[model samples]
Target: MDANDFVEIDGSYLEGGGQALRNALSLSCILGKPVRVVKIRANRPNPGLSHQHLHGLDLLRDITNADVVGNVLLSTKVEFTPRTILDNTYRVDTRTAASITLIYQMALPVLLFAGRSSRLIVSGGTNVAFAPPVEYMQQVLLPNLKRFGAGFELKVQQYGFYPRGKGTCQLDVQPVAKLNAGQFMDFGRINLVSGVGFCAGRLPVNIAIDMQQTAQREIHRLWPEQECTIETVKHSPEKTRDNGAGILMTANTTGGVVLGASALGKKRIDGHVLGSEASCQLAEYMRKEICVDDYMQDQLIIYMALAVGRSRMRTGRLTKHTRTAIHVAEQMTGVKFDVTVEPGGQTLVTCEGLGQLNKLI
Candidate 1:
C-alpha cells in the first residue's frame, strides 16, 4: 500500500506522548492498515523516538514483516506498513532501563490476532519510573484481560530498575479467533489484597520484608477483616544493573475488579512511607467505585475497540493518555467510541469493535 493510502495520525492530537505512537503501531498491525504518525512525542522533553520507542517499533517491524521508515532514534515522524503477521518466538533486549511493560503492550494486541501462538522474551526495566511494573501486569491487568477471554502468561526471571536495567521476563500468548468484548461496570466488594515486596542489586532482603510488613499492617488497619498477603522477593545483585527496592499491592474485588498501586524505593527513602503510599492508593481506587483505574482504562481502549461486540467500562476519570489512545484507535481502525461523564464525575467509555479475524493459513 502506498503511504498516501495509510491513515494519517497527528502525534500532537491529544497528550502528544509516546502512547499515540504505540497505539498506532498496534492498530496498524491488527487492521492490516499502514499508518503515518507525524510529530511523534511532540510534547515530551527531547521529543521524538527514544531507545524504548524504537525498540517497540522495531519489534513490530520484525513480527509483521512491515516496512518502517523514520525509525531512527529521535525521529519526529514515522510510517509503518504491515504486510503480514508472523507467529513465532521472538527475543528483544532493550539494552537499557526502558520499560518492558510498555514494550509488551506494543506487541500483545496484534500478536493475539496472529493466527498462532507467540512467545516473547523481553529484557529491560521491569519495575521502573513512569511505567507500569511487571507485578501490575501479572497480578491486575492479565487477570482482567483473561475475563475477556485473552490467554497469556508472564514469568519474571530477574528484577530491574531505573538507570541500570537488566531485568528479564517472558510472555507466552495464545492467539484468538476473536476477542470477547469486556464489560467492567461494577467494582464489587473487596475480597483479597495481596502484593510483593522486592529488592535487588546489593539491597538487603530485610528491606523487602519490612516493606511487606508495613503494607500488610496498613491494609489490616483500614479493613480489619481484609486479608493482605505479602510476598518478599530477594533477587541476586549480579542479575540487576543497580540497587533498587519496591512494593506492588493489589486489591481484588468480588465483582472481578483488580486495582493495583506501587511505590519505588530510593536512596534515603523511607520504606514505611513507600508501603503506606501503595496501600493508600489501592484504598483510594476502591473508594472510587469504578471497575477500571486511570491507567487500565487507557490500556483497555484498544482491546475494546477491536473486540467482537460492544464493550463498556467505567473508569475513575478520563486522562489525556486515555483520550489519546481512543483517538488513535478510532483513526486507525475507523472504530467509533462513545465517552460520557456520569453523575459521580466518573467516565463511561463504550465502543463497538471491528471484529477482525485470526486464521492460520
Candidate 2:
C-alpha cells in the first residue's frame, strides 16, 4: 500500500471511546478507504479492544475482505485495508455477554452498500448496558433509517443476557444505490406510548409484568389523556442463555415523531425503579424541543454524511460521541457538518452528503 493510501485516526480524539474505532471502521469499509487507528479507546478504564470491540472488527474485516492487523482482544492499534464489500450470510458469536446490537449497528452501514443483500445470525447479549437493545433497534432506529431509503428486518431468536450470554438474532439487509436526505426537524404531539418488558432464564415472568406495569403507570401519571400500553415477554431458559430482565419503551407522536428509552435490569438495581426511569426519560426527551434523541442523533450522523442531498437532524444536545462521529465521518469522506443552535435550545446538524456509490454494484 502507498503511504497516502490510508488515513491514520487517533482513537484518543474527542470521545476517545469504542465508537471512534467502530465509526472509523464503518466509514472505511463503506468508502473503501483504508484506515489505521491507534490507541483504541485510550480514555476508558480498559483502553483497548475488548471482546465486544473485537467481534465487530472481525465482522467488518470479513464483509469488506479487509486486511486487518492487530485484530485481537486488548489490542490498542489497528490497520484496516478493505478490498471490496461482499454480500453473504455470516454467523458471528461473541460467546460472552458482549453487545450484539453494537456489532449490528457498525456492520449495517457497510452491508447496506454491498454488491447484494446480506443476512446475519449473530449471538450475544441483546439487552446490555451502554448499548442499544434489540427492541430499540427494531422500534426506533430501523424506522428512522427508513426515511433515508434503507431498511432492514431484525428478528430475535433468543434473548441473551449478561454473564453466560449466547443469545441469537437474525438481520436481513438489502443493498440500495443511494440514500435520500432525512429531515427530522419537526417535533410533534405524542399521543401514544408503547413498551416491551421482558425477563429470561431463572427470573419469574411476573417480574417482567411488574416492570411493564410500573412504566405504564408512570407514563400515565405524566400524561393522563395519552394512550399507554406495555406487554411482557416471558422467555424460557431454553430460549435464553442466562438470567436477565429489561424494559424498552417508545413514545410515538401523531406527527411521525418517535422517541425511545430503555433500562436494563441489574443485580443491584430495582426493576420498578428502572421502569420508572425509562418512562421518565422518555417524558423528559419529549419536553425538549429537539426531534432526535441523544443516541439516535449519534447514530444518524454517519448516514447524514452518506446520503445524497443535504441531511439535517435537529437535536437538543450534542454529545462527545456525536462530535467524534462527525470528526471520523469528515476525515474518512468528503463531507462537512454544519451545526447551528437555535434560541429554542435545539441544535440543527446539517451535512451535504457524499452520496457514495457502491462501485461493486
Candidate 3:
C-alpha cells in the first residue's frame, strides 16, 4: 500500500476500546498512509475521543500536518490524511491535562521514523489514573529502549495528577538508523532487579517509604541483594490531587528489559498491597524465559517493524490490542505480520523485509 490508499478500520470488533483508535492514528502517521476509522469504540461508556485520545490526535496532527475530520466528542468516525512527514521539536498542549504519556506514545512512532533529533514539551497531567505515568516512562520503558539503540531523557518541570491536571515534561530524543534485534530469553545473572514507587501531590513521605519497604522486603525474599527506593514530592496548591504512586522493576542483563506494574487509586492507598501486587506481576514475567508482557509487546512492535532483518520475540498472549496493531500495520504497508502461539503458551511474532522501508526515507 502506498501513502494514498485510504484504509478502513471497524472499531466495534472486540471490546471496541481506545486501542483501536490509537493503533489507527499511529500507523497512519508512520506509513504516511491515510485511514478512515469507523464505529470507533462503539462499546465504550464515554467512548470515541476522550481527552487523552484527542490529545494524541492533536499531537499527530501537529507532527504530520494531517487533515482530520469528524474528530470530536464521542464521534464514531474519523478521516486522517498526512500531508507531510514528522520533523523535530514539536509541542503538544493537552489543555485538559490528560496523560502526557499516551500522547507521547502516539507521537513517538512518527518522530522515530522521520526525525533526526526531536524535542517535545508536553503540558498536561503527568500522573493520571489508568495511564502510564511519567515515573514508568522514566524508569521502566526508557531504560529498555536504550538497549535497542534509542536514547531519550525526560525532565519533569511540574506535577499534575488526576482531575487537577497541570504539569509539564520535556523530552529530548536522539534517533537511530535501526534498532538491533537481540535475545532476552534469560535475564543473565540477575545483577539487579528492584521496584521503586514515587508519591506526589498531597501524599506523605511515609506513604512512599512504607511502599518501598514493603516492596524491598518482598523482592529481597524472592531474590536477595536487590535494591529499592521511594521518592516523595510536594504539590502546589493549584494541583489538587489526593495521592499517586507508580512501581517500576528494572532487571539488568546483557540485553535487558524492564517490566512495570502500577496502580493509582483515590482516597484509599494501601502501600503494602500496591508494592506486593507490582512485585508479583514482575516476578511472573521473570519466571518466563521470554520477554512477554502487555507493555513490552506493544513497545517492541514499532522497533520490529523498523528493523532491517527478521526480528522475533516470545510474548504472553496475542491480545486484541496486539492483533489490532498487526492489522493496522498490514493495512498501511501491505506487509504481512506472522504471529504464532506455541504449546508452552508463548507467542512468537516475526517481521521481515523492512530494509526497503528504511531506504524510503
Candidate 4:
C-alpha cells in the first residue's frame, strides 16, 4: 500500500499518552485503514511505547495479520497495516505488573467484528495504578456494552498484583453484524451499592473487611437512603502470592446504570482512607444523575462511531481522554461526534454513527 493510504496520527495529541495509540490502532483495524503514529507518549517521563503498549500492538498485528514496524520497547514511531480480522485463541504474557485491562481494552474493539468467535488470554496485572481494574470491566463496562449488543465473557483465572504480576484472564468475543446505538440518558433510582474487597500478598483477611466496613459507612453518609453491601475475596495464604490489596465498589440504578470506583492499598494510604475515597467517588457520580461514569465516556466513543443510527448518552465530564478518542475516531473513520455540557453540568455526547456492518458476519 502507498504511504498515502495510511492515517497519519500524532501520538502526542491532547492526552499525548498510550490512549491515543490504542484508539488510533483500534479504529484502523476495524476500518481497514493503515495507521502511522509518531512521538508516542511524548508527554510522559518515559516517552515512547512501553512493554505494555508493545504487547497490545503485537496482539493486534497477529489477530489481523497486520504488518507492524517498531514493535519494540521505547519506540516513538510505529506503523500498522491490517489485512483482515481473524478468529483464533490468542495469548499475551507481559511478565510484569503491566496493566492487562489496558491491553484488553485496546484489542477488544477490533475483535467485535471478527469473522468468528475468538478467545484472548492475557497475563499481567489485574489491578494496578493508572488503569481501571478488572472489576470495572466486569461490573460496569460489560453491562454497558451489552446494552449496545456487543456481548462478551471475561473469566479471570488468577488475580495478579504489581511487582509480582501473574494474573491471567480469558476473554471470549463473538461476531456481531452491527451494534445498536446507545441511548443512555435516563437517571433512575439506585437500588444497591455492592463491592468486593480483595486481599492479596497473603495479607490478613481482616484488612479487606476493614475496608469494606469503612466503605459502607462512607456510602451511608453520602447517600443516607442508599442500601449497601460488600463481600471479601482473597487468594490462598502463600508467601509467593501477588502483593497488593484494594477494594472495587459498584452501584446499580433501577435504569441499569453501573458505576465503579476503586483504590489500591499502599504503605502510606490507610485502608480506611482507600475505602472512604472509593465510596465518596462512587456516591458523587451517582448524585450527578449521569448515565455513564467519567471513564466510560472515553471508552464509548469508538463504539458510538461504529454503531448503527445515532448514539447519544450523558456522561460525567468530557475528559481529555474522551476528546482524544473522539478525534482519533473521526480521523480514522470520518465520523462526527457532538459534545456539549448539559445544563446540570453533565456532558451529552452524540454521534452520527458510521453504521459500519461487520463484513465477517
Worst 10 residues of 1 by lDDT: 233-242
The estimated TM-scores of all candidates read 0.95, 0.97, 0.87, 0.97
Judging by TM-score, tell me the better candidate of 1 and 4. Answer: 4
RMSD of 4: 1.4
TM-score of 3: 0.87
| lDDT at position 99, candidate 3 | 88
In model 2, the runs with Cα more than 4 Å from the true position are none
Residue-wise lDDT of candidate 3 within 168-221, one digit each (tens)? 889876656666653435445445565566666566767666667776777778
Clashes of 2: 0
Q: Could you give candidate 1's per-residue lDDT for residues 292-352 as a string of tens digits?
A: 8876888999999888899999888788999999999888888899999999888899999
Per-residue lDDT of model 4, residues 68-109, tens digit only: 988899999999999999889999999998999999998898
**Model 2: per-residue lDDT, tens digit, 1-361?**
8858779899999899898999999999988789999999999999899999998999999998889999988999999999888999999999988899999988999999988889999999888888999999999999899989999999989888877778899999998888889888877778778998888777788888788888888877877888888989888767874778888898887667788989998886466887887888888887784678888988998899999999888887799999999998899886999999888888999999998876767
The alpha-carbon lDDT assigned to residue 303 of candidate 3 equals 57
Clashes of 3: 0
Note the residue pairs that clash in candidate 2. none
Query: How much is 255 displaced in model 2, in angstroms?
Result: 2.6
